[model samples]
Target: MLMNPRVLVIIPAFNEASNIESTVRAVVDAGYDYIVINDGSKDSTLDICRLNGINVLDLSQNLGIGGAVQAGHKYARHYGYDIDVQVDGDGQHDPKFIPLLVDEIVNGADLAIGSRFLSSTDGFKSTYLRRVGIKWLSFWLQLFTGRSIKDPTSGFRASGCRAIKLFCENYPDDYPEPESIATSLKAGLTVSEVPVRMRERQGGVSSIGGFSSVYYMIKVSLAISIACLTKRS
Candidate 1:
């Protein structure tokens, strides 16, 4: 159980059977109300959650990363959990930084992001093209939201009730990237970036690669452009 019971960490996982157990144990060690969103994983993901007796919200079909996370937000609202964090299921997000996030939330930020690119972090790569794309999106977010976001696409982040309510109502479905950052900022929630360590994936392969990378960049760029132009009402 968490020493600070109000803080929750929501891990959105899909087909991460090999990494889930260790991930859960580590986060529990860090002391958090850990909730896992099994996004219709085809493997024994749900079984693993059940066997471990962990809090889980299982979906009937794949809802992508955005849906999994937003579902967790909905859970927070329904259960009245005061604070929530997002960590990757592939074990890339380190649990060592959970304390820092908790402190940030306690200090008054609505969202605390673990940014790998905030400084020189070793053993991780975002590629040049991806970095360019990130900068492009960041510029747009800054323009629209008037806030500097270091890692807009970062999956490792913490959010309080302010962000949870916004995301529960409006989050992207697929290829959720910096656009979510824009949406969060538009909602008038406080957002900040904290330095955190990230490791390479322990298992499985990335879905965005080869020609898909180019397509993803183009699609996301267009989506971000569209998002920036419209002011959220």
Candidate 2:
């Protein structure tokens, strides 16, 4: 019944009051339909969204990234959106690359990840320690899924019809980006990485920083391994 694929940009915000408005505006200015999932921030994020007339879904409690993103996917699926793109609310993800990711999905990829390391562009590539962790995880992910994702932890990704449905049914919780990729590959979905230039967060603190980076590497690596093994069954 539809002539064109409907795209929904999902922005999961938690205590991103300082950056939510600008992030949402970028998506709006890019001319894509979007929904902001307010992940129970104790700040004025919800008020800002309301004041700016941004479309948002208010969660009763904090659901973390996975839960908030899943909520958006479920909404997209329910509304018959043909594509779902995730742009983080921390202002790290650039909206200009949305079309490129969507193009990959339209062509054939079920999941298209916007990879920061795939190209030789001068972009914000996180800290050195985090990059090391990402590469280590990437090696393990290739071992498990046979896919060489340059940026396994990239939250800037787009999912097509199949992936949107699959994720809505079984999405990972906690730190989910890498685990979600493993899950997709194990489920026989086509996953590809497209080069993208990301920026440093314009405002607010990152969830993973300092000593927490060590914890992130361990936890996400374990989660990816578990997702692959479980989905392999």
Go through the candidates in order and give each one's C-alpha lDDT. Answer: 0.81, 0.92
- Residue 108 shift from truth in candidate 2, angstroms: 0.4
CA-RMSD of model 1: 2.7
Per-residue lDDT over 51-164 for candidate 1, one digit per residue giving the tens place of the 0 to 100 score: 989888999999998899889889888888878888888888889888887678778888788888775768474778777777876777777768888788788888877878
- What lDDT does candidate 2 reach at residue 186? 85
- Per-residue lDDT tens digits for candidate 2, residues 1-233, read 22368999999999999999999999999999999999999999999999989999999999988999999999999999999999999999999999899999988999999999987999999988889888998998998878789999999999999999999999987888999998888888999999999999999988888787878888888887878777343
- Model 2 lowest lDDT segment of ten: 224-233
What TM-score would every model get versus the actual structure? 0.90, 0.96
Task: List candidate 2 segments past 4 Å from native.
Answer: 1-3, 231-233
